[model samples]
Target: MMTRVVVIGAGPAGLVAAIRLAEGGARVALLNKGTGGLQLGQGTLDILGYGPDRVERPLDALAGFAEAHPGHPYGVLPADLVARSANYLRDLVGPALLVGDAASNLQLPTAVGAVRPTALASPSMTAGACVDGARFVIVGLRQLKDFYPELVVGNLVRTDLPGGGRLQARAAMLDLPAREGEIDSTGLTYARALDDPAYRKRFAQAVKAVVEPGETVGLPAVLGLDDHNAWSEVAEAIGAPVFEIPLPPPSVPGMRLNRALTARAKAAGVRVVPGSKVTGFRASGGAVDSVQLATAGGDRDFVADAFVLATGGFESGALTADSYHNVHESVFDLPLRRPEGHLVHGDYWGDPQPLFTIGVEVDEQMLVRHPGGDPVYTNLYAAGGILAGATRWQEKSGEGIAVASAVRAADSILAAAATATDQGAAS
Candidate 1:
């Protein structure tokens, strides 16, 4: 008998699981509400501790773990698989990896002047570069605009990068003015700028003019570069090495990855459904049998041998728990572990000490746990950012954790199915 697995959501976590499960000889179907939340990100996998100190290059650290744990769900595969995945990602976006030593000093150009200091690899390197009196030159486009330079300056001030002194930053707006009463979209806007090589070159020249000689310029992640090729030219022409800063609220990288993965998953024979919300689950004894999905056509039942929940946190609209101390799984009514307070602290900014607290409890095998600390579902598994007890943001281990957890979950599910098949054959 063929084993069918239903996966919800198309974020990094969900996509990774779907691919791995398919490779494991399981029939996988992925469902989501369009795109998901990945596009909003900057697309850089933040591996915080890869250096000798284990305090930076976090992705490197995770890579080491993957290397050690051969056949583990999150472990690194053969060189070919790694190369293929990296190439696929690079083709989809600008670059797969942003390499830089943590201890090396970076020269940052701000509004006032240039500042040189030891820079750490982060999605947003501008803030950290502001230390040692780095001058920041913020470039803003006229029409395709989203980031605010003033806000970044404020954050730099809060961090006290410049010897606890004030930051020197300047803003240059690249006016891509729009027509009156016209709606501007991300694709169209990007197309308008990227279609013309001369336009992009002129824009780069304008940006270069604003910066002093030998000063590194900080720009938004959206540089209007070619989807397939542009990073090298853009970096060289701009003179100063450009650092792409991540935008808050809605991340562009996260969104792009979601779309790319969704398309790839569908093309690979996986049924990709969106806007179909999972209302509840049908369970008997200790196992889930089916899921109730609500779509425009009305409610329908999707039965599968196994299930993978990747709805994500509150942002992705997966697990919804109210202030009354009551939590709803949203789809299967799966039991969740909730903290008393919504957030550990009042302020939502910065690392906030312990950071956010919203995840499910899973055992070593990646099986969701019950209130009594026992596996709730034999064939059910959970992974990615939704897994409890790990903070992806503060820990700077989002991509690593998601990939690792998904691998583990898929392996466990496959192992369980194999065991069940063997038992039935014996019986």
Candidate 2:
């Protein structure tokens, strides 16, 4: 019989775990509360960004990360797998995702114009990476509320590209299309408009007017939602390389990635149950017997041979705190890595906050463990932000930790199931 595996949380880690488990012949169910963290993310996969200072060589930094952050998720797993998983994700997402290699980092400009480093980025996000002697003309939609061309240009002007190149940035805006009032004029609305060839052509012309030859044109990430060819058409029309700078919240690129992964997961035979909030689980004898979630009808329980908890930390509500300041793991109420500060903190720019680093402690096999280093459940594993160590946002290793741990946990589950089958056969 195929192993029945349940992966909780629909973020990159959960999705990846479910997909891999299903592909490996396990019956997998992926559950999510809301859309997960994709929409709120910056859209690019940042394996590791800064290590005390900006990191030019990500793979090299990863080698030392285990030493500096001995309790980090990357530390528990082999360094080579962590490195390989980055490449694995780029391949898994397909070439269209346009990820860079682990050997180096991609330096892209943020919405505010400050240069940031990431290991993997979308094609549109990496378009203007040629910072050395690079000049930019940024375009914005007049009606879009969040994106500001002036802010992006101002921040970019102060930034010199990664490769010792001088930077020049200019700002421009396009008047809303005459029919723009018909829609809400949001980033999603703007992307749909650009999906139409006629509208895209006109918008391209507006951006082209501000850009000179050989200079890349940067625009908000609203090029197109489902239309992969939209960015190319605009670039072809403008006669220059066109790139997208991400917006603050509800990021378009991030949504696109989630959609892509979701589609692929569905195709791979993974059962995706969205909007299903897992409220609790039943455990016995150091193993999770079943998971319970609230349904429209009422609460439902699911039994599985193995479980992977990719439930995110504070942001996704997988981990919570009360007024008393005690942080609790929402699902199994598993022991946390650190008890006192379920959500403690330091100054934003000062030392790393103790709260973010506190999470479920896992063994090398990725199995969630008791505080005393005993496995809470031999068949229950945890990954992503819920797993302990490393300030992900500050270190910029969010995607790296999520994908690597998920993949590793899935592998361990499959191996354990196979061993069980062998033992049963001998009996």
Candidate 3:
């Protein structure tokens, strides 16, 4: 009999876990409330962004991170597993990203022209890498709101280059081909326009006219919606290397990953249930027997051999706080580890913010546990931001934690299934 697993939350962690379990010969179902963090992120994998400062060799620096913060997800999880998960992501979302040279972080620029640390990025986004002999032309569309060419130019000119060389920077505005009397336009709107091959040709010409010879051109992440090769085709037509700079929240680059991964999951025979709100579960003995998801018709019950709670932290509303500010882990009602006394809520850079790390307490096998240290359910596990102890935004370790913890949970369930089969055969 195949091992059955239900993974809640459709973010990178949940998606990865579902795919991994199915690949491991398990029947899997991925349930989610809504489109997840990928829409809000750059869609690039950030392993460990700032280890106080930017990390060059991510794999090597993790050793120090583990030593410093023993209870942190990375600290407790095996380093080899983390590395393996990264490779899994790289392989799963092929062509949507350009993973940096092994063992090192991909230093890529953001929308603001300031570079940040990431593990892998699409080739278009990777063009922001400050390579030798690379001069930059930052182009902003006048139609595009929330994008300032001058501000981007100012930051790019003054910002530190990764390769430690002086390069010239210039800014230009592209009057992107658009219909007249258009009320408002967003990145997605612009991307749809570019999807028309004729419009894209005209758009590429406008960019080509402005770009100087041998200068790599940078633009907002609105390239194409249906076509993944829009940026590359434009680059080839314009005779310059064009790359995308990830914009503000509801990031386009992130959307690309979400679409690709969801498509892949469905193709792999994984049933993906969207808008699924997990209200509760039924437990028997020491394991979860069934999960309940609320619906307009009524509550639906799903029985599985193993379960994974990848419902993200507060930002995703998987974890909520009451009027008295007492935090609650909404699903499974698992015990959360938070500061006992007054939490440091100040906006200071180095202050220990208690709110960020309040999440489900889990044991080494990725199984949920009580505050006093007993497993809440042997078959129930957790992965991603819902597992406590690391401030992901500051550390830039969100993807790393999600992928690593997910792989951990999947492996644990597979091992448990194998053991059960062996015992049953002997009996």
Candidate 1 global Cα RMSD: 6.8
Per-residue lDDT of 401 in model 1: 56
lDDT of 3 by residue, 165-282 (tens): 5456789997764655564678888788878888889989999999888788988998886688898889989998898887897787888889988988888889999986999999
Worst 10 residues of 2 by lDDT: 176-185
Candidate 3 segments whose C-alpha is farther than 4 A from its true place = 131-133, 162-166, 177-180
Shift of residue 294 alpha carbon in model 2, Å = 1.1
- Global Cα lDDT for candidate 1: 0.57
Q: What is candidate 3's local distance difference test score? A: 0.83
Each candidate structure's TM-score, on Cα atoms with residue i matched to residue i, is: 0.72, 0.95, 0.96
Query: Could you tell me the TM-score of candidate 2?
Result: 0.95
Tell me the tens digit of each residue's lDDT in model 2 across 300-381.
9889999999989999888887787778898888888873433555567788878778799998889988865789888999
* Candidate numbers, best lDDT first, in rank order: 3, 2, 1
